[model samples]
Target chain A: MRDVAIVAFAQSNCQRDAGAQNEVELIMPVLTEVFKQTGIKSAQDVDFTCSGSCDYQQGAAFAFVAGVDALGAVPPIKESHVEMDAAWALYEAWLKIQMGSAESALLYGFGKSSPGELPIVLSQQLDPYYLAPLWVDTIAFAAMQARTMLDSGEITEADMAEVVARSRNNALKNPHAQLKGDQTVADLLKEATYVSPLRRHDCCPISDGACAMIICTIEKAEEWGKPYAIIKGIDHRIETHHIGSRDLSRSVSTEIAGKAAGVANGPVDVAELYAPFSHQEIILKKALGLGDDTVINPSGGVLAGNVMMASGLSRIGEVAMRIIRGEAKRGVAHATSGPCLQQNLITVLEAK
Target chain B: MAQLAAVVGVGQTKYKTKRKDVSIAGMVREAAVNALEDAGLTWNDIDAVIIGKAPDMFEGVIMPELYLTDALGCNGKPMLRVHTAGSVGGSTAIVAATYVQSGVFKRILTVSFEKQSESNAMWALSNPQPFSPHLNAGAGGYFAPIIREYMRRSNAPYDAGIKVAVKDRLHGAKNPLAHLQLPEITMKEVEDSPMLWEPLRFLEACPSSDGACAMVIANEELAAKSPRKPAWIRGAAMRSEPTMYAGREQVNPRAGIDCAKDVYAQAGIHNPRKDLDCAEVYVPFSWYEPMWLENLGFADEGKGWELTMSGATSLTEGGDIPWNPSGGVLCSNPIGASGMIRFAEAAQQVRGEAGDHQVDGAKTALGHAYGGGAQFYSMWVVSSEKA
Candidate 1:
């Protein structure tokens, strides 16, 4: 396979509400920023374009179509899209570059989670015939898993609060974070619960945002590189859609993807994980076989701002930024989709 | 760097304006089963499933793929959903094939569909969002201005587009699966058709059809052993550009041209008009046949209309590069599925399976689809002989 690297990255601000700006309006600025910083003058120069987004966010069909205007897509360019997160879109583009079909590729993902009742909207991702009809919101589902973990002594409310505290404290340094403060674990534990066993702090804030990443082959990577992180390996896996079919407390998909991407082999200096819910972080860490010594979510991660599709791609970008800055030699970035991380993708990036 | 891929099987649902007889799951299954049958395989033969559709609003279902897992026989298997506006069908197929080309999955089932009967496509397409003014009504509303630009640039006669509409509709007569089969469709009738968007007569545009198209793709080895003759995939390419940009050419997009050139190079075709036996190009509107003909390298700049006028795309006329023998998108369009239909039709022609609309002696064919203001493009070349 040909070498590919994340050459540039940009994103819109993470916000609680996207009042008038829809998906397209939200993503346009990010597209410009990504290209502007990369010094790529023409959209025509990009060989392939791929995106990660869902139709539910816009409450409209073909929501991604409107995004074309943002890319200045006239004079058509090779493109593809995934209903998954933008991180997976990046994976697709990486494959294209590896196949030698494209020299450089653009990847983006966005979602406006504040328009309607986000928890209710997310319920639609459940099994349509069975679980979805129950109208169980995401918090309720997470609470149930939390209860299982609590009963099994795998984790505690105190541990959950610690995760929340550490994540929020870390977010104080991130300018794009939607939530950040120096709240202590004891104080977080005292917060009111949105759902039983799951406090507001335990859940990722509903965020509206968009993000873009540019990747290229080794030669193009050199052309665009001021600093870029090479994607060493990337892979994704999906478990059964039936929620009850698998153990809810474990993320089998993450394990599979991590193994496939070679993340399970050894230790990594940094890790960026998409854990919208606090307890999910614990689940993900175990699935990925990360030790306590590994520094995770140095970029504040999704717990600071959960922008659905964009958060996943942002994880890769965050890790790549670290590699670019010479902060880390190797990093593992993971993204998840579906209920309880039913689908997961992992990418291992390294500095050459 | 990439492994070769082949279209081992192809399938499509019977095209219609409303497919209310079955649920969304049933609709997808119809096409998937047909594809499996063509590949001489069963549900277990597929290692993964990739699906595409225009939008959630089109069918009043959000992220319908989650609900459709069982319908497409994706249980305990990898499933991906792709959405890139109108060209999603084509892009969806490309992603599925990539799995095989990347040597990840041996056999993959890719499908695209839209059930327009469940909801009004016009209203869905025009559904106003926040910030953006509701200027465009439907797809035609956005494309009409581009079409007008094409008219001015080409300096083609007004009758040129009307002729395309008449020809495609006439071709639709032979396609049992085509939605519009106006046996007496004439240029005079198209000229009299109602104008929804300026310069775009109603009859010249594609009808909103409820349909699905499915294809089974495999590696060279599996394809060679398939029960049916495989349409060896010579090349596949996709491209995209921003929808709104200063100096952006809407009439003949650079992405389309670049995509065509990329795919042709991969297929090792230097002269498309002679190298390709036939083509199933995406032409949601009648005039698109000639426009895309030029875009796809079948005609010179500003002379694509001449090919349409010369009857080079007719079904029985035996034109060198017979285009849309299956009547094309002007006859039927389930936005999400339209691209795959072009691909499936191309494969069908190569397989000698297009019963009535079959172009005789078709060996090498091109399938093309574009969406999102003509920004997203997905195309492929298939030949009877393996490369």
Candidate 2:
């Protein structure tokens, strides 16, 4: 495989409601930041460009097409888009580089989840004939999964609270994080359940934001003289979509993808996981076989602020940033789609 | 150099206004199973699945791939969902081909579909948004002015679009799966049809369709071992520009020209009209035929209508360079699947498996698709021989 590395990454400050800002407005700032970081004037500098976004977040069809305006895609450029998270867009760009179709790529993901009923909008992702018509929102599905873990003695209410408390504490240092505080596990446990077993703190806050990243062949990174994080391995796997068909207490897809991504190839200094719920962080940590040796979610992860499509790519950027900043030598970044962790992607990054 | 890949198998569902006999999952599976069967393989042979469609609103199903994992045999494998407006089908196929060309996976199953019957596409496409003009009235309403501009610039005959509608419908008659099979269609019928958009008549527009298209792309090693001949992928290119921008040329988009040039260059073709055996281009409205003919270099600007008037783009007319032998988007437009149908039909031509709509002794062909006010373009060149 051709060597590829993430040399630049930028993201908007996660906002609970980016009032009146359209999709293009939410995306332009991050695109400008990434361009500034990489010294590239516009998307025209990259060999290829790809994006990830969902239209439901904006309550409009073909909403992502507007994102092109943020890139100033004049004279045309090789570009593609995915309905999934931007991490998958990154994967597509990586494949392009691997195929020698491009030496460098620009990718981004954005969402205006605050414009609509975020959880209810996510219900449309379920089985259209069965689950979607019933309108079982995303929180209900995650709540059921958390209840399964509680009933199976796999986790306790305190365990979930502890995860939330850590996320709140870690997020205090992340300026872009929307939710942050020094709340303790005891304080979080006192909060009433928002959906039976899942408390408000246990769930990730719906956020409106965008993130952009620039990756290139190792040679290109050297030519730019930028600090970079080498992408050693990346792979994704999906489980059966039926909620009853799989074990909710365990993230089988995450385990499979983590293994395939070579997560255990060496010591992981840190890991950034896109676990929207507090209990999911525990499920993912166990699934990836990370011990106390690996610091998890130093940037507070999505539980601090979840920007739908952008959250997944932000997880990857968080890990790569740590490696590039010399805060960590190696790390694992995970991105998940579908309810109950039905699909999972693991990307391993290491410092040069 | 990147590893080579080829289209070893192709399958498409019978186009219709509504496929009531099957669910969305069933419709996609039918095409996938057909493609797998054509490749003489099974579900286990595919390493990954890449699916594409226009928008979640078109079917009221958000990210349908999540619910379709089992139907596509994508469980425990990588599944990528591509959405690039109307050009997504072709983009999805290209993404699948890259899985092999990148040497990450050997066999990839790529599918694009639209079950427009589940919801109203016209309403979904024209949903009002803040600060945006509400003047948009579906795709035809947007393209009619562009077509009018082409006619004004070229001074082409008023009947140029009518002829194209007649010719493509005739071609659609030969393909059993096409949604519209108007074997007896005439220019008079098209010209007399209700004018939906100024120059574009009701008959000149493509029907809203419910269907799916699938293809199995494989690495050179696996493609060579396939039971049937493979259409070697000589080149694939995709280009995109902002939908509305100052000084943007909507009549003949620069993205279309650049994409065609890039793919042709990769295929080692200097003159598209002579180097290509045939083309299956996206033509939802009849007037786009001549407009794209110029954009794709089949004819020079202001002269594309001349080629159309001469029957150079008609298969039954014994034209040297026929376009859309299997009818194309004009006959069967499932929005998302429309682009891949062009791509798959191009492969069928080179593979000598197009049956009744087969181009004679076709060894090289071009598949083209454009979307979003013609600002997005995807094109690929395929040949019988490997480079």
Query: In model 2, which runs have C-alpha deviations exceeding 4 angstroms?
Result: none
Which candidate's lDDT is highest?
2
- Candidate No. with top DockQ: 2
- Tens-digit lDDT track of model 1 for B131-237: 66675577888888788888889998888889888888888899999998897987888999898787889998999899999999999889989998888888988
Model 2 CAPRI rating: high
Query: Model 1 interface RMSD, in angstroms?
Result: 2.5
- Candidate 2 per-residue lDDT, tens place, B153-266, comes to 999999999999999999999999999989999888888899999988999999999999999999999999999999999999999999898999989889999999999999
TM-score of the second chain, cand. 2 = 0.99
